[model samples]
Every structure is written in structure tokens, then in C-alpha cells.
Target: MISKWNILTRRKMRGVYIIAVFTTILLGLASRKFSHLLIPFIANNAGDFIWAMMVYFGFRFLFVHKGLLFAILLSFLFSFGIEFSQFYQADWMNQIRETLLGALILGKGFLTVDLIRYTAGILIAAVFDKRYSS
Candidate 1:
């Protein structure tokens, strides 16, 4: 029942989201790798902020049909949930955290500041998406 234009728009949006996710990931990695060259505040916080932006883009890619508010809420829930999950110190979880991939995904430890970084990142992403996606 969808029009051809709607289908094309969805595909285009998905592609945009995919690119945003990868770009954010690269920036996050670069922030960590090149932290010594940057300001101390950005060096410490950019990775987390970029990580949250990547999460928002990823949800947008997956839920391309959903409204911007839906993506915003879902991204916030997901990012915050992952941050909170770090408080669980079960042996199995710790084992997973030990791996490089798991460490990147789940993070090594919970920091209160990460929540602020995530909130800012998500809000900024939503603002950009709202402004540019139309």
C-alpha cells in the first residue's frame, strides 16, 4: 500500500543513517586514538558522545519508518540501558567485558559523566535529524 516515492524516501533515509553510524564510529575511534592532540575535555568525552550519536543513527536505520521522536526515545533508552548494565558485575558479564569487542560495546566501567554525554549526543543528533531529514 506504500507509494513508490515513500519507498524511495525510506531507502534514502536508511542509507543516510547507515553512513551516519559509520562516520560516528570512525570519529569515536579517532577521538580515542588521537586524544593526546585534542583538548582535554573533548579527548575525555568525545568517544562517549560519538558512541551515543552512533546508537541514535543505528536505531534510525533500523526503524526507518518510525517518527523522529520514536528514534530519539529508543536511542535514549538503549544507550542509557547499556550504560546502566555496566553496574552488573557477574562473572559471565565480566568475561564478556574482557574482550575488545565487548569492551567497546559494553564499556569497561560505568561513569556518571557518560550519562550526560549520551544525553547531549542524543539531543544533538535529534536536532540535526529533525533539521536535515526533511
Candidate 2:
């Protein structure tokens, strides 16, 4: 029998997953390319939004039956976990942060304001997902 986790693996949501992937990439590139044009608030926190969406999409793509609130919660928990991880500052962790990908994923520093950005991103993602799913 098919399970809830198997829902996302089916072809029905392929388009949703593809769109999420593209949107995530576009947001990431746009954040970098237009950083100069954006205000400090947007420029500094845009990545948090993208990160939240990435996590949201990831959960929707895996646990397709899960609800919007679930996605939002999972994304926030994960983003917060990663942001909090920045406080470790161990030698190995710092070494990882030195790399481009690592820095992008783990972040160089912790900012409390980032939590808001992550929430906004997940909420936006949930809205979009609800719209598209219907």
C-alpha cells in the first residue's frame, strides 16, 4: 500500500517540486545580483527567506501529505537550528564556514532578526503551496 511519505514521490507533484527548485535558485541569484540595489534590511535578510523556502519545499517534496502549518514549523525549526549553530564557533565549524558553500548554508554570524525573515519566507511558501495545490 502507498504511504503518506510516498505521496511526494509520485508524479502528481513533480511540477510543484520543479517550480520550487527554480524559484529557490532565482531568489538566491537575485539576492546576490541585486544586493546593491536593495536596502540593508532586505539585503541582509533575503537569504533567510530563501533558506526557509528551501526547507519548506524540501518537506513538501518528501512528506507530501503534510499540511502548510507543518511545513512552516519544520522550516522554522530547521532554519533556527542552523542559525543557532553559528554560535558553536569551534575550530572545525569555523573551518567549514570558511568555505563558500558552508558560509552560505551555515552563515558567518547569528542575528536574531533572521528569525523573522525565516518566518516570512515559510509563510510565503505556504501561501504559494496552498494556492498551487488547490
Candidate 3:
């Protein structure tokens, strides 16, 4: 399927990647600040997943120097960093982290599921990247 679209030719799809990354960062900032506006468990974690995927696909689209292993490592770093960020930053953000689904998605203080989900997300993005993007 990727054989059709010349996604990275003179067209310069860097803008797409840039938009994805920017949007991810923007959403994170929004979640941190406006967490009170979100529904208890669902919104934050769902946002987390989407954010992770956005960053993954954003980087995957932008750079040409990563593999599955690298992507997984990136995912772990991103997830772990975001989780750790919950400990000592963004008061409202921390509140959102207190929910059940939030714990499951953001993770329970520290656990493996978060990492696994990160890897899964990154793997999915990378597969599509290899398959669909030029």
C-alpha cells in the first residue's frame, strides 16, 4: 500500500510530523492545565494513549534513524517520564493521575503495563509507518 504514495519525496512531509508533535505537546499542556474539565477516568488516559501515538507517529514520520527497538525505548522513556512527571508537577495534572483508568493508562505509580502499552503503540505506529508511509 505504501508503494503508492511518495510521502517523503520533494513534498516534504516534515510539516505533517511537525503538526503531530506540536499537537501532542499542546494537548499535554491542555490536560495538565484543564484536567478539572475532563471526566474522571476516561479523558486523561485516553489522551495519554493518543498523545503517545502522536509522538510516536510524529517522530516516525520525521526521522529516519529509528527501529522497533528504538521506538520501544522511546515509548518507555516517554511513558515513564510522563508518569514520573505526575509525582512533582502540575497540581491538576496530578489529580487526574489519581483516577483508576488514569492509573491504568498513566500507570500505577510504577509498573509494566504502561511500558507494554507504550511498546504496543509504538509498534503499531512503526508498522504503519513501514507499511503505509513512503
Top of the candidates by lDDT = 1
**Can you give the lDDT of residue 18 in candidate 3?**
63
* RMSD, candidate 1, Å: 0.8
Ranking by lDDT: 1, 2, 3
Residue pairs clashing, model 1: none
lDDT for 11 (candidate 2): 56
TM-score between model 3 and native: 0.48
| Candidate 2 backbone collisions, by pair | none
The segments of candidate 3 whose C-alpha lies over 4 angstroms from its true place after superposition are 1-11, 61-109, 116-134
**Residue 31 error, candidate 3, Å:** 2.1
**Residue by residue across 69-106, what tens digits does model 3's lDDT show?**
57556766876687665556466765767886565355
> lDDT tens digits, residues 1-134, model 1?
99999999999999999999999999999999999999999999999999999999999999999998999999889999999999999999999999988988999789899999999999999899999997
Model 2, span 16-71: residue lDDT tens: 76679678968976997799999998898787788788788888877666677877
Highest TM-score: give the candidate number: 1
Q: What are the runs in model 1 whose C-alpha is more than 4 Å off?
A: none
Q: Which run of 10 residues does model 3 get worst, by summed lDDT?
A: 1-10
